[model samples]
Target: MQLVVGRIGRAHGIRGDVFVEVRTDEPELRLGPGAVLLTDPAATGPLTVESGKVHSGKLLIRFAGIKDRTAAEALRNTMLIAEVDPDERPEDEDEYYDHQLIGLDVVLTDGTPVGELTEVVHLPYQDLLTVKRPDGSEALVPFVSELVPEIDLENQRCVIDPPPGLIDLAEAELDGGPEQDR
Candidate 1:
């Protein structure tokens, strides 16, 4: 499995240095000299990191053979990936990667399937689970333990106990209107 670690933002300066938005919590553990970065599937090979450093909470990196600003600029928006084994040790009980949550079935307490997990947005206050309904509508549910009471990864299902008016709020937002009592 290839996990995305960072995204090349832009060339920083005249040199080959490029600013990268770190996507992983373990940036320090992943970014290092001699580390290999795969931009995409069509690339000839992984780009070897000649040098790297953390700057202003982002990764500043220079790749081998990329020695100019033009060369660095060409890599903007490229995703840096690291090959990870799927059989690796498990994360802590409460922690889960966004990839693991996406595609999971989202249901009400009574097993009524409301939607499917499409994405997870990490915000400062809380993570938001983006659920795509069968009708092509979408709902952003706050991943609070109170609302999302249960998550069964193996079975690919989640039980949600939405607060009063939250489902209406989500529906209103999806419909681009204010919530009105039915």
Candidate 2:
């Protein structure tokens, strides 16, 4: 199984080093030096990690033979994929891959059906679970443990304990209190 490890961002410097958005929870293991990763477009073939460092909380990576800013910039938005074992599991029991939760049904804490897990959005600060509602709408639920306290993978379900306005922003806005203005 191939998993996306990182996505190339803008060029960092003139020396071919480019910033990357780390996708995998195990960046140190997946984005380490000497790791060979396949590309999405395949136009650049495989890429070998020559060096990597964190700058201002962002990860910067340099690929072997990429010697200029133009070369690095050209690879922007490219996804770096790595092969994983079929039976691989995260070292931390609480940690889960996006694939594991993608197809699960999302319900409220009281078991009210909300949506189906469509995708996992990995942001710099936090992760979000994109859900497809029955009404053909979409919702991005932050994957915080407090709001999402349960992940019953055995039953293929996720329980969401949404805060006020988290799920039904329109309803919350419509039922505005005295503190809210028109």
Candidate 3:
């Protein structure tokens, strides 16, 4: 399986170093020195990492043969991908890879069907699960333990305990309360 590890950002300096918007949980393993990553455009790489460091809390990476700012800048927005075993699991039992959760059925605590887990949105603060509802609409559920109490991978399902309007915002709007009367 190929997983996205990071996206190339602007050139960091006159050197071939580029800032990276990291996407992987294991940056040390996937984006470290000597790691050969495949590129999204299919033409830009198999780029090998020459060196990497954290600067001002951002990841900066230098690639072999990309010798100048212009060359590094050309890689802007390019996605870096790493090859991984499909069956590989995260070291943390509580953590899950995006691929592992993508296809699971999403249901409420009482077993009410909500949707299918479609995508995992990784944000700076928290991850979100994109759910495709039966009616073809989509809902973003915060991937927090309090709301998402259980991930039954064995059954291919995720159990959520959503507050009102979290999953049914449109319906909630339709059933307006005191504010609607005003």
Pairwise lDDT winner, candidates 1 and 3? 3
Ranking by TM-score: 3, 1, 2
lDDT for model 1, on a 0 to 1 scale?
Answer: 0.80
lDDT of 2 by residue, 103-164 (tens): 99999988999999999988879999998999988988899999899998889999999877
Supply candidate 3's per-residue lDDT for 17: 96
lDDT of 3 by residue, 47-151 (tens): 999999999999999999999999999999999999998789899999999999999999999999999999999888999999999999999999999999999
TM-score of 2: 0.72
What TM-score quantifies how close candidate 3 is to the native fold? 0.85
**What count of clashes does model 2 give?**
0
Per-residue lDDT over 144-181 for candidate 1, one digit per residue giving the tens place of the 0 to 100 score: 89999999987989889875546555554666454433
Ranking by lDDT: 3, 2, 1
Pull out the clashing pairs in model 2.
Answer: none
Q: For model 3, what is the C-alpha lDDT against the true structure?
A: 0.94
